[model samples]
Target: MEVLALLCIVSVAFTGLTRGAGLLPDGPLNAAVGEEVMFTTTLAPTEIPFISVAWTFGDKPIITSNVENLTEPEYEGRITFFTSTGYLQLRNLSFNDSGEYRVTIVPRGEQQKTGTTRLDIYAPVSNVVVASNTTDLAEFNSTVRLSCSSSGSSLSVLWLNGSSEVTESDRVQLTDGNFTLTILNVSRFDQGPFRCHVFNPVSNGTSDPVNLSISLSVSNVVVASNTTDLAEFNSTVRLSCSSSGSSLSVLWLNGSSEVTESDRVQLTDGNFTLTILNVSRFDQGPFRCHVFNPVSNGTSDPVNLSISYGPENINLTKSPSQEYFEEGTDISLICSAVSRPAALFYWFLNGDKLSDTGSELRLMNIQISHSGNYSCQAFNPRTLRDETSQPSVVSVLERISGSSVTPSTNLPIEGKSVNLSCEAAGSGSRMWMKDGSYLILADNIALYDNNRVLSFRPLTKTDSGEYSCNISNPVSSDGASYNMVVNYGPENVQIAGPSEIRVGETLTLTCSAESTPSARYNWTLDGAEIHNSSVFTKDNTGLSDSSNYTCHAMNNITGRTSSAVHELSVTAIPAQTSGCSAGCIAGIVVACVVVCAAAAAAGGGYYIYTRKKRAKSTGDEGQDNTAYSGSQELNYADLMSFQSKDGVTVQLGSQNNSSKDARDRVDNSRPATSSPPTYDVHMQRMRSAAQPDANGAQIYAQIRNS
Candidate 1:
């Protein structure tokens, strides 16, 4: 009956439906495989009665209900309907059941209503697989093509490296609806356990892991030596080889022959080392090393070995093998050795190192001090080894050419003796020669000590000559000569000076003598020693200096003396006089006498008058005046008498009557005058002494009296 009602409802169109009923899904009707879906219908209030409810799948009935539910044969166990609410439920849906589903309602008194909705179903993805074109990858030299597959539709595939999505880059490509991943020029960085992820709207799945491995090739093989390959004998050395790869196998070779480990040879660092112990000459050659792997192989360049030895068999040779050499001759010595490397030479003299380095040693202008036992040493610088040679004896002979002749004294006196000695070396016979001839002894000549000493009693002019000493030996003969000199005394003595000289003139006299040795001179005047020099000078010559000057030259060497005399005459200078003559002095004396006489007469008259006046003024003195005047006259007489005797004038005066007596007591007392004397009295005295009869004293007396 419910099916009949659904068919009747689907055949009859419900027109002019008044907002009475509707249908809606509880959630989206899109479904996945094995998921359930529900469709519900709603009714509005109306004056109608509920008749039936039905659900269909793409024009086919899925379920119907009036009072109970009924299902189609296709959805018999999968579909159900609610009787009170008119809701439909589909269980375990699949993609084939995807279509439009409808719900219809029939009312008894109102218009019937029908509603529709869509149903979408999808299957869950499963059984995913990700595969690569190649599993074994060579880094940077290969490509990989990866594909992802699944059993679901409308799916998305993604590549993942250990849970991280692989991004698309220049080395990665995607194709075929994200089902394929292509990796171009893959490197070691691309190595991974990769997986493919497939997803759909309802479910997702991951493929099994695909592990990628990169194969790296071996390259850049290099070999090195720990120390310098130049090894000395009995020394050890090591060589090493290296490469840039994994799982490496190393091999060593010596000149194309494989080298194996032995007691003295070792391999270390996984067969990469070649160690040679106590190296010998046989171990010196080219060596090689090889490195290989499963991917590639490499060979190292050859390493050459060097070995060194010692210096041995040292020998020394001299250029001249003679017994002896001259003191000033040049000589050479050479040294050699048998060594692997050329040796350095060192010279030694008398077991002392000379600090010289060379193969040959040269001595220039050798002296007697250079004589010694000489030797040399040969050394190897690299091996630090040396060898010494035997010493050689050197003798420097004293030849006869070294003989000499010597004089006992350089300077010989004329009457003194001298000796000439001859000297020679090596017990040689000697002889004396004078002036290149054999000496024949004369009267005063003598020879002693096998003619080596020639003596002269007195050295004379004949004794001065070249004396030669000759030496004759069994090995050599030579001679040496000397010149002897004899000294003499002063000869040809002479004097030099001016024969005549004037007063106040300078005089120079030089005396010299000719002698082998210079002579000293002595000068004398009037037979008395005056100077002891060869030259004499006398300035301002006077008459007292006039004498016979004698010079004596004496030789200090021979003690001999000689003399010469030169007479020096000195002229006298006349006395100078003034213009005044003796006659003018006489006239001056006469004038002085006349003035004195007048002064005396005037003084006498004045005295007489003064005495008279004094007597008249005092009253009773006329008689006294006569007496005083008379006494004054007597005093004047005495003064005139003394003046005439002594050639000097005097004056008198009286303070009282006793003045005349005082005047007589002082006879020498006289008054001085302001004027100079008319004539010099001391000169007058000299003239009077010189000429006793000239009357100079008498004239002075006359002038004083006057």
Candidate 2:
């Protein structure tokens, strides 16, 4: 038995040694679907050669090799082996190919070596879907079940709210490898976007988010006043109502009656507030708010509204009211009112407030200055209310007992009539005086109306004086004086100045006028007014400036004017002889001498020419006359006469060749009684000469001597 046991032990040892040959993967040897997987076997180093090496997937042989590689039909194109290392690679692995892979090696002399490896083939989770039983989630009223599905092997399912994993809780149950989540009593807190995640060894995938929404219904309503304490008349008030949940409708009610919106009442802020404008006593009431939703309704408790008002029907009265009273009279004024709260009193005079605070206003002593309108006001301080009374007028009159002289005009124009009246309180005799002297009436001054009126027909400067009117009554004697003023025009107007003025000479003219009031002067050139002063000055007079100048004196107070006119003649300046040069003066003198010499020479030339011509013309006539005269020794005057065709006589004088005895005898024989021919006759002889030269010598000599 020992020897047999030894042989069995040896056999067992041999099997163990052969089985020690195993496969080693690079890592865990996991692969996704459609990927490659490898299995390899290592034999102890030996001189013996292997008979065959084989690889199988699960229980099926996929590749076998000895000198070369061989693959089964199932893995023919997808399997490869390294003959030198006995390593096998499988390509395009599927999920069904996931399992243990074994490889066997047979050496020439050693025991056969085999290796096994586990290959996990995974298909990444695909076609993932998350579905919920219901999309609508209700607060505290619904449960939601969600499921996740995918078409992949070895998948793990997870629930996610965004990127965070969904934590497990009492209300949340997860089953089916966490592929399904059950939420109990879904609430607003549970409402969110949920997602399902599926993962495998190779990859992970997530489904689209599924959102949950929560619905709610109205729960409670609250209504309150914006101002809870008090509401006043004619004041604005507001009430607000609110609800617990969304999508709620609200309404306001006043003591079970629905309130309607009007001009004075309005609903605002999406029907959350009820506003009452200009609140009155009728607006006070108990108000409530009602709110409703599709599933529930709620109502708020009533809130009471109270309003306050005061002080009405106010009036004022005067004690012993009268339109007019005498001085030293007393008057009383009273103010009254009807109000919930007693009203305070205030007195006003001519719209001015007085210091008196009582209801009665008393005037102890009235005077003329106190004649004015009076009024009173009643006010309620608590309610801020007030009322005013109509104004009452009071007048105080005085007796008219003093004497006064009233003139028709205080400023009477000169030469205008004025009437002065004397007044007395009672019937009395009246007398007038001038300047504190007894008055005497003249034709221009007359007294009328029982000597009470003093009339001046035409007022004068002397009429401007103090005049008094004296009156005697049964009870008194009085007098009044008036300072009368007579306004007179600008009169006696005169202007003083030189009538003739030279160019480049300064001229001044002064205007004066006599009047009651000093007059302002306006100087006018021609018809146009020029200056406003009493004196007018011209620094340099120009020839063209000569004009009719007038001065107008005006009394501005009396609106009277007087004017004076004067003619101004401006002469040109004399030529300046000192400014002329000696050459210029000599040239002027030479021109004058030349003119005179030229005239004299013309006279002499004409004299000679005419004398010669006359001598020749008279030669024939003289010869004829001499021949006639020789017969009778005719007198020279008679011989000189010659009858012309026009019946004019011509006398021929002795020629220069005439003998001196003949000329002397002619001169000595002339009758002394014959006055020398008158000057007119002489002139006629000169003018009658047919030829100018015939008389030129004699006329020239005569003109020269004369």
| lDDT per residue as tens, model 2, 1-706 | 6577456535544554333233444334678888786665443333334688877767788877777767788877887776666667788988788777777777654466666667788886788898988876556778999999998888888788767789789898998779889999887767668999888888789899998766576766888787644534557889999888755678888887888899989998888899988665445678889887544678998887776644555676766667666667888988887644677888888899989987898988888777787887887777677778888887666543678999998778888999999987655678888998899777789999998999999988778889999886433467899989888979999989999986547889999999877999999986787899999998857777798889999997789889999889898633212222334333333333343354445442111101100011123321223222221222212122233334443333334533432322233332333222234433444453333342434423332332
Stretches of model 1 off by over 4 angstroms after superposition: 1-22, 26-28, 40-51, 105-114, 161-164, 221-241, 245-706
lDDT per residue as tens, model 1, 607-642: 111111111111342222333232122221112222
By TM-score, how accurate is candidate 2?
0.29
Best by TM-score: 1
Model 2: worst 10 consecutive residues (lDDT sum): 606-615
**CA displacement after TM-score superposition, residue 346 of candidate 2 (Å):** 55
Off by over 4 Å in 2: 1-21, 26-31, 40-52, 106-111, 120-123, 160-170, 175-178, 200-203, 208-211, 220-241, 246-706
Task: Work out the TM-score per prediction.
Answer: 0.30, 0.29
